[model samples]
Target: MAEVKLFGFWGSPFSSRVQMALKLKGVSYEYIEEDLPNKSPSLLKYNPIHKKIPVLLHKEKPIAESLVILEYIDETWEGYSIMPEDPYERAMVRFWVKFLDEKFLGAAWKACWGEGKEQEKAMEDAQEVLTTLENELKGKKFFGGDNIGLVDIAANFIAFWVGVIQDVVGINLIEEDTFPTLFKWSEEFLSCEVVKGCLPPKDKLSAFLLARKEAITEAAKSIVYK
Candidate 1:
């Protein structure tokens, strides 16, 4: 058996993505929960640049960044590849993943966390981005075809985290009527046992996010008013 370990924060969508990948591949590994507010010495040492969670330590070697780690895990492991075999299909999956990360995910965060005009603008921008994703997912059960792939893993935030975020901040950008396709995708994504099992429990996740929202928003406001 190979030695594998994962350092992650439970509430992070990025961490959860890695978790799901490992689980889907049926790879066994040790899990270390990081305190994000006060990061661990090992975490900082392992991923000195980002100092972020969800670092995969494989055979005592460290890999940082969830997306990078996901690819590593897929390549290293044999079962249930996160990517498609075709080159063009692979590129399209990567494109959507990049779009999800660069174009929309940040907007979702701002829509939930930003205040006043900032929040309003974020909500508007998020809706537009989500509509694009919604269209991409129009007829597919999951991105990159029927089975969950890299694009779907990248989109894990929408499947589980966004609802708690919206609830915490009292803003909803992914409503059924407005984002029907995305909304349906969320429903189906969560229904998958592999994905659902990796998710943070709702009550616990809500409590954690509510506190996080309060802290981040208050800090943002202080900076603006200062």
Candidate 2:
């Protein structure tokens, strides 16, 4: 058996992505929880560039970046393939993954930092992103068609984190009536055994985001005062 280990933070969606993939693939690995504010020496040494969580150690070799780690895991494990086999299909999956990563994923942080008009603008931007995804997922059960695949896993964080941000900022971009497809996907993704088993508790995640939003708001206030 190949030795596998994962370094991650509990509340980080990026880390949760890898954890979900690992569980789905039936790959057993040791999990080390890292404190992001004061990262462990091992995590720092392993991921020198980003010092980020969701680092995968395979046979004692560390691979950083959650997306890269997901690919690595999918390739290394044979039982369940998360990515599609055909080149064209694979490219299509990658396209949506890239879109979500580049556009929607970071908008929550921006919205958290903005105030008044800025906040409203950020929410609009995020809503547009969700609208795009909602349309794309209109007829598909998952991004990879019937079964959940790499794109679905890659974009899963948006489903989970958006709710946390919505709760923190009191903005709901993904209402059932407005973005029904996306909202349904969120429910299905969260209800998946692999995903449901691994997610951080709801209250804990909400508290974490609430604190993060408060800290960002306080920092913005300090800057205005200065």
Models 1 onward score TM values of 0.93, 0.91
Model 1: worst 10 consecutive residues (lDDT sum): 217-226
Error of 1 at 25 (Å): 0.6
TM-score of 1: 0.93
Q: All models: lDDT?
A: 0.84, 0.80
- Poorest 10 consecutive residues by lDDT, candidate 2: 217-226
**Per-residue accuracy of model 1 over 131-215 as CA lDDT, tens digit each:** 8888888888888577888888899888778887778777777789988877887888889899987888988998876767667
lDDT of 2 by residue, 155-205 (tens): 776778777767777766677898899888888888788988777887998
